[model samples]
Target: MEDKIKIHVLNTGYVEVDEALAFKDKSYNPIAYTGLFRSNKHKVKVPVFSYLIEHPKGNVLVDTGWSVASREDYKSHLPLKGYIASKPILPSGENIAEQLDKLGIDKLQFLILTHMHVDHVDGIRDVQDRAEFILVSRDELKAANKGGGRYIKELWKDTIFDRFDWNGEMGPYFKSYDVFRDGKINLIYLPGHTAGSTGVLIKNNGKFVLITGDAAYAHASWENLELPGIINDKVRTLRCLKWIQKLSKADNCVEILASHDPEVKPHIIEI
Candidate 1:
């Protein structure tokens, strides 16, 4: 019998942050920034998503949406717009726990993070009790701790790492590896949005899906191989985008999903 797979895209909230402000001035071409602003009206409403995957072999979570506290913490960082746009609400009409319950999954076998960004890891505490967290590498945790990573320090204050006895598994970096040798799911390294940003590839019932965590905010960016204005490493980020484009075009069954694209959010199949 063919294995069944269910996927859910849990929306945290809508955000409108300036992409140009995210990076240092003069680090990137003004044309790219100008084009993004011109095309997106100088602002983008990003849909923060957390994915829940259920397969016959195991239950997994691709990313975790921000918690209420974490959302508050994000507000603290943005004094200008923080007060106006800061709250914890899921667009899918259910909290993370409630959503899991609806799916009939009491506990998740693994919680794979695409990266340790604030919005993505904010819901970690909610699932810590019921799942083992998987990250791309220890470098991500280290970057998070040092306050040099994507997530701010205030959001990390209540991380579930301590509860897991501080034991977490990292990486399948710069290469593709099967989560289970049977090849039900695969983690592909596509760094540059962060030091260890990764993507999840799942195959079930003859369909393949690729969940890219912040590697590219929109599918158009991936198609154009356009790096985001606020990337840590320009070369690496561009390379990753190229790789995703190649994969998406060559493989008919592969669907590339981004974390913050509002256009793609509505089309996602809720589990």
Candidate 2:
């Protein structure tokens, strides 16, 4: 029986979205993330990451990176506007299917989509069949279904879904879903990046690791209180940033990984 919860960071691939979509007004400013939005499109390769959680109850996956089909064909699965907005690039054998195959993960207990953004949920086509149950922030699911240009409707199109929404909260900062109800794994609500952008908190034997997807683009945003580009609400995003800063201040927090942060690339963070 496995008692320890081990987390493997799977580097599925990368997607290029506008720099402004990443940092607040990175499109134009001296404080630009890369010092300048050189390209007319201002595109940057934000590494796409997924996590495989090996737990006592069952294996769980967080954020599927890209579908193999998308690599082969994008016109069929992605919105034309979104396809142009975020140019996803994947090398041979880097899709979610191959990544899971490399790890010999045939099945999963849970599949958590941090948000509905194309980079986060597009890979579902590659691994959705093996997931036992899905988890999502209720508001996110609603927003994705609203037919936004930022999301790929084809990803969830015509597919039946079974999901448990994260409806509970911890203190004033986080609304969470307590998986296993043992305080080991919590899907935290951190709105502002989207209507339902959320993070995950995992603890085992007193060690902790929290993964926030696009809640902050990199350590810079979360650590320095900088804002990301594609924001829904400035007020909400700032409040969420403060919450993250507060949580990171905890002595027990081992590491905080942002979805697109290059520093955390393809690294397994143990809990």
Q: Against the true structure, whose lDDT is highest?
A: 2
Query: What value does the lDDT take at residue 80 in candidate 1?
Result: 26
- Residue 52 alpha-carbon offset, candidate 1, angstroms: 0.9
Model 1's alpha-carbon lDDT is: 0.62
* Error of model 1, residue 142, in angstroms: 2.7
Per-candidate local distance difference test: 0.62, 0.79
lDDT of 2 by residue, 42-151 (tens): 66787888899888888889998878877888777666765665777888888988988988989998888889888888888778888888888778888888877476
Q: What is the lDDT for 121 in model 1?
A: 68
lDDT of 1 by residue, 20-48 (tens): 52232424455443333343444445677
- Model 1 residue runs over 4 Å out of place are 19-41, 70-94, 153-174, 266-271
Query: Local error of candidate 2 at 51, Å?
Result: 0.6
lDDT of 1 at 179: 67
